[model samples]
Target: MPPGPERFVGRERELRELRADIDTPSLDALRGRPAATCRVLLVAGRPGSGRTALALRLAREQAARYPEGLLYAALTDPQGEPRAAREVAAQLLRGLGREADDDPEAALREALRERRVLLVLDDAASGEQVAPLLPHGETALVVATSRGPLAGVADVRPCTLGGLQSAACVELLAQAIGSTRVTCDPRAAETLAERCGGSPAALRLMAGWLADRPGMSVTDAVRVLPDDDATPLERAFGVVAAQLPGPAARLMRMLVLAPGALVDAHLASALAGCALEAARDALEDFARYGLLRRDPGPGAGTEPAAYRVAGWAVPLLRDALEAGERAEEVRLARARMLERTVRLVRACAASAAAPDEAATDEVPLALRFADREAASGWLRRRLPELLGAARIAVADGELDTLARRLASAAVLALDAHGQAAPERYELHGLLLEVAERRGPDRERAAALINLGDLDAAAGRTKDAVARYRAALDAARAGRDAFTLGRALEALGDSHLELGDRERAADWYGRALAQRGERGELADAARLHTRLALLHTDDGRRDAALREWRAAAAAYRRLRDHAGYAATLAEVALAQEVSGAAEESLRTGQEALRWARQADDARLQRVVLLGMARVLERLGDTEGARLQREAADGLAGPGDARDS
Candidate 1:
């Protein structure tokens, strides 16, 4: 496996005794290969009896004996559906960094023929699923976990995992809540663990409940967790659900319908149409009963709030929601949550805008952020939940408008922060689908350009050109000059990458014309720099110089001191690259002065270093030495280059 829990509680004696059945000595481990299998240690038990947990612990304990690698595969998907044997085999093969399109199982067996590897097949639905997965090598070990004995399989050594020891159960509780609470009354703690039937899951649920109520005694738990001679594993979840407060109990029902695994106080609040504190209290109640696990999310590090639906609790919550909640109630809850998500996503994007742009974007005072940095952090932190919400909205028939709005806001925020290319590619595709189906032709054009940029970044120049072409159509239909410029610029870049220099130049000229009409000085300056780079890299020295002058003129007119300084540094680098030492020195000096005025440390360092190189080339050794000292004093941890 992927390493099991860092802290394993209980089952010490079980692990010690099971080693006799599972562990093989060094000499005996190298015996001739079996006809079809190696030693199979099947750990079997009831679902909530800690079967998988015990198997994980046992398999991990043998790490030294099988150092080749530990390959694990869950025979069942997360939805409790059985996975095909071949699929599981393919996953195992991939884990070993080997693959066979024709036959993964055979390829896997060959790969592990003489290797001492640990193969963990978890949650085997039947003997048929387990049979095909077994390695036919004597040196390999198969540690399979199942809810019951694997029928029709012979000569398999078995280990039965069950309830925790009473002492271990108490220790588990103490670990979850605290020793002080358990130590306050050891007798009551023992009773509480005993009442939980020593079932680890039950003990954990009971522990979470007590942890929520610090003042409540373990005796109170012993009483509340009922002991009617029925198995706690079978009854604890329902009993806890029944015992929660009315709103919390209802919230528990609604939680089952959540689109994603994660939930925050804000999402929970909207789901129930309740106050934030009320939703938080409900989440606390659900978490206390193990219906939801406290997972690290957006709030975990920054806000101290978040929970994920516990996998085991899904079916139970679904049953409860079916029995107690109405369809309309669930629908309205989803609507409330979706609308809230749209508003929040829009505000998050707006929060990162400059004051001039933000004036036109009015957000609620409660949702607005102080500045771009804060908004960027919020976007990074909440991106997962936002994605989840977007998925739900896109799928909901009644939420198309909200979904389209969310897609627009989220895509821009992701672009602003320079998030992952793959993720942006996926989200941009979704935005395109939503925008096309939902109206607003301009957004469709924007989405096409956004996705085209991703495709270009991944070296899919032809695909990017295709998208840019489609974007040109959409932009023309919508009369959006800004998006039109973007499409034209992307086409130019893609064509350049494909070595169609003449076509690239034509697109660049068209894009510059569009940018001029659009009246975005920043855009014009950026385009000038792009053309400068293309000319410089193509050895068109005079054309590159003209483009750099245009970029500088645009930056100066815009009063962008930092932009002007950065542009001059680029010019200095270009001059040095073309062997104009005197021009490079003069340009570097101008760059340093502007950088000082803009207080741009990064640009200052770049210019200083550029000047140092020019001085060295001119044989002015002392001047170069002084420039080197100045550059060294401005050095930072990761400022390796101008970028």
Candidate 2:
């Protein structure tokens, strides 16, 4: 047996079928057809469903019967360069040690007649390409696999493989991530199984990836895994290129050029340049043909779901889109795709914190209430397509408007989702190009601010500061005070991350002054609080207290109770640091009330600890003891903080 780690799991029924096909009928008359009658077996299954695996496994198991050897050949005919049956036969003959140059059909028949061989013709384009490869006599057993039913082969036992069972999927995960890890967390295992769609190839790929990253948890892996629909989606769309009739196929190719994953019936209608019903009919036809997967529309009764090209066919759809003669149609398709992607990004970026009912105000009506996970999923899966579209738009040069929109959309997607963000290279590269190409200084500044903030979150402090500086300059040049204030604050945060307390204080102070003049109360208050922390670090206790007091009043006026409470905690800290024992004790107690009311346990604990230290310094030993007890209670379970 092979190593258990690599051994096949699931498919006991399929294995039994293959075994029954191979076994000769017993001498008993009731046993029916003998294995000799099963000379040709066609194993049919969908792409990536393990047909190839079954064929190889069955061939290996029966190797003893065919002592000569086995031959395998691929028969799919790629477009504009179709692989012919003659070529396949000639190749199989050569694998059997015969000259391929000899008359292909004669060589195949002569070679098979000479010995006991097992032949596997994989991915046959159609039944006709497979007929010539069939054995003429019982000297050999032949197996062929295809996406669809392969007719014309008489008496061939067909074994079609479906996805693995859920249990088998779990077993595959255990093999991939090790049994101990999976068994430790059964839920993660099940989630992984469900997400893999029970496809052995996908399971094996995921497992191999997990096995290499020993410390990565199964749960974390599941969280990061792309939706099951992605690959199959590409495959389904690929067939649009191969299987659709002329104009419909052209429409599909155009659809693939779409920027984001989705293309609504209206826009798809426009791109296909057909009437609404005709376009809708084409989309439905594509769905019926499995060329695209439908995204359930909102409250539309699910009868008229929005559709996008499926995942697996993405590449094929792409090739077709790029290959067709309608250059103008392709260009327009690219423009539309960019336009939609930009719209999504703008909506997400602008309204990330919006209440659900109002979130769609800035977004497309179809996209409102679309789960963040699904939106982010589409963006991540089609990231390459998104980036490619942007680059193409840029290269077209004349479509600078489309390029700007694409660049901004890419930036927005990145802004809203961090690790799950679309590709970084495209977001930044395209933004830089668009910024240089256009004179919209404020727009350029806004894009830079987003890029800088993203860099700061990603821990690229220096790069983040550089972006912030450029944004600040652009904002100043555009006389945009709002953008300038935001940029300065971001720059301050970046410097704070680098531990440059003085420069961080200077930046925040400038931001605060500008925000104050403009009544940017919320921002100005936050900046004041940040500046106070630096003052305390430098031992300017009075200055720190004054700044915190000013910030607290600002937050209070703005009705930001949480912000006011946070400022109080900071004030309590500065007082203790400055040795104002009595004042610190009073301030901490007042801060505790606000923190607790805020319902933030983390903040409450910080205030409790501050009170304990303040009482200790004020020589109130018993009072300090009580505060320590309260702090410990708020701290909850082990304070190790070590994951």
Candidate 3:
């Protein structure tokens, strides 16, 4: 079982009842029946009612009894879409060390038939998804958690979880905020818990808020927690939000526009158009109020923490955003957010292309970082928020240019980080929608090309080809060589992935020519490298060498020592493969020298290993051994190779 909260303080009675139900055999099983055998326990609750947490805790406590194995699966994706039953079954099969057959459900059921396994199905959407995954044997136990009761399923024991008891709520608060704080004013603590409707989620948030303010007493908390006629959770969130300072309150409302679960101070600063320090302070303030929860920053050192609005607080904050005067504030905040996000994402792209030791002047002073690593870290941490801001920007209609730039920069950052999940495809679709609606042909072409790239990455070559063709048309309409070259190249790559080598070569040639005509040396160099790989795949060694040499020269001209070194390494490998061992040795040596200049240990290692193999081919056993040792030494601990 995964770890539960550090301080679990409630649900003893529910836990006892659950244990009793698990130990008690079903009436049908008692009659020695095989048809209605397996024991199924359904734990149902609302979104933030700690349903998953309690389920996990029970699983951990009872794990020892099930000797076969413990299997778990989330029946829904993070976006709350119901995950396909086949996918969930596949997960279970993998857990059981078995490959899923055509019918994953059947496979999983069969695997668990004779085993006393504990299977946990979390966040189940409907009975259909749960029914097929249930264990068929009497020995096995299945725990299915859902927001509502699985009324459609037969012969299942149901356990409905509600808010914590008052005592439990107070205990949870004390556990989170500290005993001294709660014990200092026991009556006030109980009042706070009862006012929060004894909901563990609400209590936890309130406790976290109080924890952040060491000087704040329980009485002070109760005094500030306003009275409201709304739902208990909503009223509790309102009371917390009402007590926050003006800037912090405004920031909380703006956070409703943030996409996804987490945001960093940089994003907050952008959204609020405030100083980074002020943005961070506001976030900390919200954390103190339990309106937000903090997570460790992306990288090491003193990086600002990431935060998410408390689950219960989100709807309330969103309500504030859409209601009355706050609506206009949301509009301006989103615009500022889009502007700042675009600039930061652009900086991320620039840093990835040419990592530098110092921040560039082009980056806003507030957004600048110490180096490329810091910039990239910021981008990685904030990609979801950036994508979210892009969606909001597109929806706003007037920020079309900002939306286009944000989409372009975000796509670049995603590519740089090699993130090719469903979210990337979704973002590209959003970008395409915005581009087609309000952007120029160039932006539309870029969006289309990005979509093509995503399709290619997912191995949908035909779809990618279609998108690239559409992109080419848009690029032609715009008469932009950069966009045209990219579309042509993507078309070539998609066809190549589909194994149409002839068409791939033809498209590559056109793109190369277009880039050359437009003096896009970097792009041309990249195309040359692609062509080189294509030729090599077709056993055209001499052609590959020619392309590699062209690529190396372009990198050298641009003073990109890293790219030059990498291209040189490829050139040397081609030389060795073509029986030019002596030339390969010298080229490999030159590659290593450039790798050193670029301070790329990974590149240096590659060059050394290549040289070692070439030396072995040249019958210099001692030289080969020396190079191998040097390469191995570079692989020692603390090398920290780039991804």
User: Which one is best on TM-score?
Assistant: 3
Sort all candidates by lDDT, best to worst.
3, 1, 2
Q: How accurate locally is residue 227 in candidate 2, as Cα lDDT from 0 to 100?
A: 62
| Residue lDDT tens for model 2, 257-316 | 554445666456546665556767777665544345455332111124566554334556
lDDT of 3 by residue, 1-643 (tens): 3345555768888788888999786777677766454788888988667776688788878988988887777776534568788867866675565655567898888888878888888889898898888878678888888988786677777889888888888788877778998888999998987777777666766776687677999887777666676666776676666666777767777786666546667778877777878988787766655556554344111334676655456667767767624556667777887776677677666666554543466666545555667766565545545666777788888787788778777877767755443456667788789878866898778878888887776677899899999999999999977788888988888888888998999999999999888888899899999999999999999999999999999999999999999999999999999999999999999999999999998889889999989988989999988988888778848653321
lDDT of 3: 0.77
Give per-residue CA lDDT, model 1, range 536-642, as digits (tens): 87889888888888898889899999999888888888788888999999998998999999997777887898898999999998998898788877889876633
Best by lDDT: 3
TM-score of 3: 0.61
Candidate that beats the other on lDDT, 1 or 2, i.e. the better one: 1
lDDT of 1 at 507: 91
Candidates ranked by TM-score? 3, 1, 2
What CA RMSD would you report for each candidate? Answer: 10.2, 21.6, 10.3
Clashing pairs in 3: 209-288
- Please state the error at residue 424 of candidate 1 in Å: 2.7
Better of 2 and 3 by TM-score: 3
